[model samples]
Structures are given as structure tokens and as C-alpha cells.
Target: MDAAIESIRSFNRFFTRHVGAIDARFLDTDISLPEARLLFEIAQREPVAAQTLQAELGIDRGYLSRVIARFEQRGWIRRDRREGDGRIRSISLTEQGRAAFDQIDRRQRAAVAQDLAPLAELERDELVQALTKARLLLDPGAPMDFVIRPARTGEVSQIAARQSILYAASHGWGRALEVLEAETVAAFLRDFKPDREQCWVADLAGVIAGAVLLTDEGDGTARLRLLHVEPFARRRGIGDALVRSCVQFARDVGYDRIMLWTHTVLDAARRIYARHGFECIDVEMHSEFGDPVQGETWRLTLEA
Candidate 1:
């Protein structure tokens, strides 16, 4: 174990030197690696909560605070204070910040291209796979723990809790969503039919990162329920995998059609649904989750 650790550290030292990560400025930019990453994250998820950002980066609060303050002073970002809490701030990029981020992103991509220029197509593929594997090994807690498996005992409540917490934090939907989640999961559990209904949990390093459920809705139709992915673990194929699981399961169980209810604001989920042949069949305006959202029902018929 010690030898393996030393080997990884040695590789990191060499990699840092090769990438100029040890330099005072990253990629010859004015910002350090941490600052560059913070900028990138802010740009990616604008109107993001600072606490969520801190959790996503897993960085020191004090250090991140200073970086954000610097950005504010430089007119690169504007942090809006919450009405009830003066300390709670939501951060968004200014025009200047967007321009700066674009410049940084261009150089970052160019640097990667230059690094890969010497490799053949096959070698490039292998390098990417190797890098992904290295990250999976180094950071066991990372989203790389990509596995889709069934929910275990006592997992229903956990799934509900995660959904509740994430929706509240991201959408400000409040406790109504949480109560609905709890009821939905509880009903699923109480009326469990192994052959007819199933819930899949996406596990990341033994922790639940996301979940979805396929349940019998009668009349040869199944309903997809509670599809969600953790914010930090998104864009890594977890959401797609969960959707595929439901589709495949529905086909396997001889369901003639599958349907789901979701809000229009969930663009990512909508994309996933569309990719899997699901089409919006109906839409209605509703304020079920504390906002005037268009509730949509999407459906896909199975091919015999």
C-alpha cells in the first residue's frame, strides 16, 4: 500500500511539472488552478449557491471566501444576499467574468489539445480511459463509482431524503416536494411487487448518487418515477443509465408503453427522456411545487 501511494505521488509530481501546475500561474494565466476551477464552476452553474459550490469543490471555506471576494472586487462576479440571511449569498458571473472565463476555457482546451497532439487516435482513446481509471482509483468518493443497482432494505427513505434535499436546494421548492417524495416512496414500498415494480439506485462509492423507479400503472403501461441525479455527479452518464434501465425493464416485463410526469424546468431529464423515444403527450399548467411550472406527461410505446 505504501509503495502504491508513493507511486501515485511520484506520478502526480511528474504530471504537475509536465502541465505547469506547479507554476505560480496556471497555464500562464493570471489565476491559480483553484481560482481557474472556481471560475469554471461558477460559469457552468451560474446562480449557484455558495454553500453548494463549496461542497462541490470540497475546498476550504476560508480560501474560497477570499477568492470570491477578490472576484467581487474585480467586478467579475456579483453575489446577491438572501433576503432573510445576509451571509447567505448566491453567486453569478458578470459580463466581464463571462469574457474572462471564455478566454480561460479557450486556453485550457488548447493546452489539452497540444498535450494530445502527439498521440494517435487509438492512443488518445486509451489515454482518456486510463485517465478516467486513474481518477476513479485516486478519488474513491468521486462520481466515477458508476454502478446502477436495486434499492436495498431501508433505502426508500434515504432515496426520498436525497431527492427532497436536492430539489429544495436547487429549485427552492420547499417541503411540499419532500412530503411528496416521502409519500411516493412509501407507497411504492408498501405496494411492492417484485415482478411489476422496481427501483434502481445509482451508487457512487457505496453512496446513493441518484435513483429512478419503474412501476406498473395498469392497462399494459408502466410509469417511470422519481428520476434524479446528484448535481455534482451529473453529466457523467448516470441519468442516462437510469433512464435506460427503466426502458429496458419495461420492455423485459412486456409493458406496452411507459410514461412519466415531470416539470418543464427539468431540461436535462427532458433531454434524457427524448433520447429514449419518450415524447410529451400532454402538458398542463400547475403550481404543485411552489412555482407556476408546466407539468408534462411523456410517453413511449414499446416495439414488439
Candidate 2:
């Protein structure tokens, strides 16, 4: 915990200085960083309430009032009393304020672009992904906009590695599980059937939040495999979305049924499976992970 705390603090210190450097470039502009940020916010949410802005920015009410006063003095903003409650006022940027915002926005973007000029395309992507993951980790309640897309090359191995590490840490599973995941991933790629089999990943920006794969099991049956969500990205319906996409793909590919094997300890996953109309057909005691465990086989029938 101490190491983690120190690491975060070190990063915070570096990032603070880095931002100060970015702001230093803004010296030529008329407005300061805080004022520019507030102006941008007002431009984004025009006719916004002062209380709302205060809550969103988490700044002192007195400080916010002073900023508002400054903007008013410069004829950059106007405020009007609410139609019903004369005490409540709504604020909006004037045309002059918008011109200022546009100028500031352009400078900010150009400064950041110059800062990132040295990094390659891939490095920039990785940087953005790392920042997104960090923000999600710190504030899980923040809005998560993700996409379900076909798994690309190298992503399969990444999914397998993440699943292996997460399961080993969370469930105390051994190398047996990891080996199985690796082998399955390898075989799936080696003899991949593009027509009938499919794999999808929940992409949070450039990061993989979750993954699910459908493999043809001969005849008219398909197997759902490697369904796992990152711990931090769980509870946001990523798992359910992965499973849903897999099942829909299986059905679309003319599969009559889909099956999956899961352990009893994975209640959340089991619940997701059940919600997708999968029924547990069998359970058995197995030592697949170097310990006796109850494993169940679930099957979902597809409608023609």
C-alpha cells in the first residue's frame, strides 16, 4: 500500500508540474488557466446556473463569484433571473465571450498537440489509453463510453493474459487455468473459422475492458469461451454486453445452441449467463485447477 501510495503521489507531482508547463505557454493569452477552464465550461453548458458550475468545478463559491464578476466587467457574460424564482440566476456567455473561448480553445489544442509532437502514433494511443484507464480507476463512477468491436491481432493474446492474471489473483487459480486459456487461444487462432467463429472485445478507448469468443463445436453447437471482464471495468455491464454479443453472433452464424463451462465461485458471471437464457445442464466435481471444485456446464438454445 505504501509503495502504491508513493507511486501515485510521484505521478501526481510530475503531472502537476507538466500541467504548469502547459499553462506557462498560455501566458501570452489574456485569460489564466482557471479562467479559461471556467469559460470553456460555461461555453459548453450555456445558460448554466452558478450553483451548478460551483458543484461541477468544486471551487469555492466566493472564488466563483469573483470570476463571474470579472467576466461581467469585461462584458463576456450576462446573467438573468429565473422566470419563476427571481432569486435564482442563469448565466451565459456573450458573443465576445465565445470569441475569447474559441481563441483559448485553439491555443490549448495547439499547445497540447505540440507537446505530443514527438510521440509516434502508437505511443500517443498508448498514452491516451493509460490516462483513460487511470481516470477510470480513480473515479469508477465517471461516464464510461465503450464499444464492442471485433478482436484484432495481438488483442487475443492480451485478453488471454489479462484473464489469466485476473483469475489467478482473484480466485487463487493456478497455472492450469492459465495454460488452458493460452492453449485455447492458440488453437482458436491456429484454426480460426472466419465463417462460423467470432471474437469480440469491449474496448474502452484503446483499452480492452472485456472479451468473449464463440467457437464452432462441430454439428450445430457453438462454445462460448474466454468471457472475462477487467475487475475495475466490471459492474458496468461490460460482461453482459460481451456475452450478449457472442450469443447474438452465434445465432446469426446458424448455431442451434451455445454452451459454456464455469465454476460456482463465479456467481456474477453465472448470473450473466443465466440472464442470456443459458441453463445449467450438468455439474461435476473436478480438479482442473489443482483443487476439487464444482463446475457447471450451461447451454443456451437458439431460436430459428
Q: Provide the overall lDDT of each model, using Cα atoms, as 2-decimal numbers.
A: 0.87, 0.89
Per-residue lDDT of 1-304 in model 1, one digit per residue for the tens? 9998899899989988887776779878788888999999999998887888899999999999999999998899998887887888889999999998999899989999999999999798668766654655556446355799999888778888888888888789878888888888888999988998899998765556689998888999999999998765666789999999999998888999998999888999999999999999999998878878899999999986
Clashing pairs in 2: none
Candidate 2's TM-score reads 0.95
RMSD of 2: 1.7
Q: List TM-scores for all candidates, in order.
A: 0.54, 0.95
Candidate 2 per-residue lDDT over residues 126-159, each given as its tens digit = 8999998988888876787889999998999888
Measured by lDDT, the strongest candidate is 2
Those runs of model 1 whose alpha carbons end farther than 4 Å from true positions after fitting are 1-143
Question: Highest TM-score: which candidate?
Answer: 2
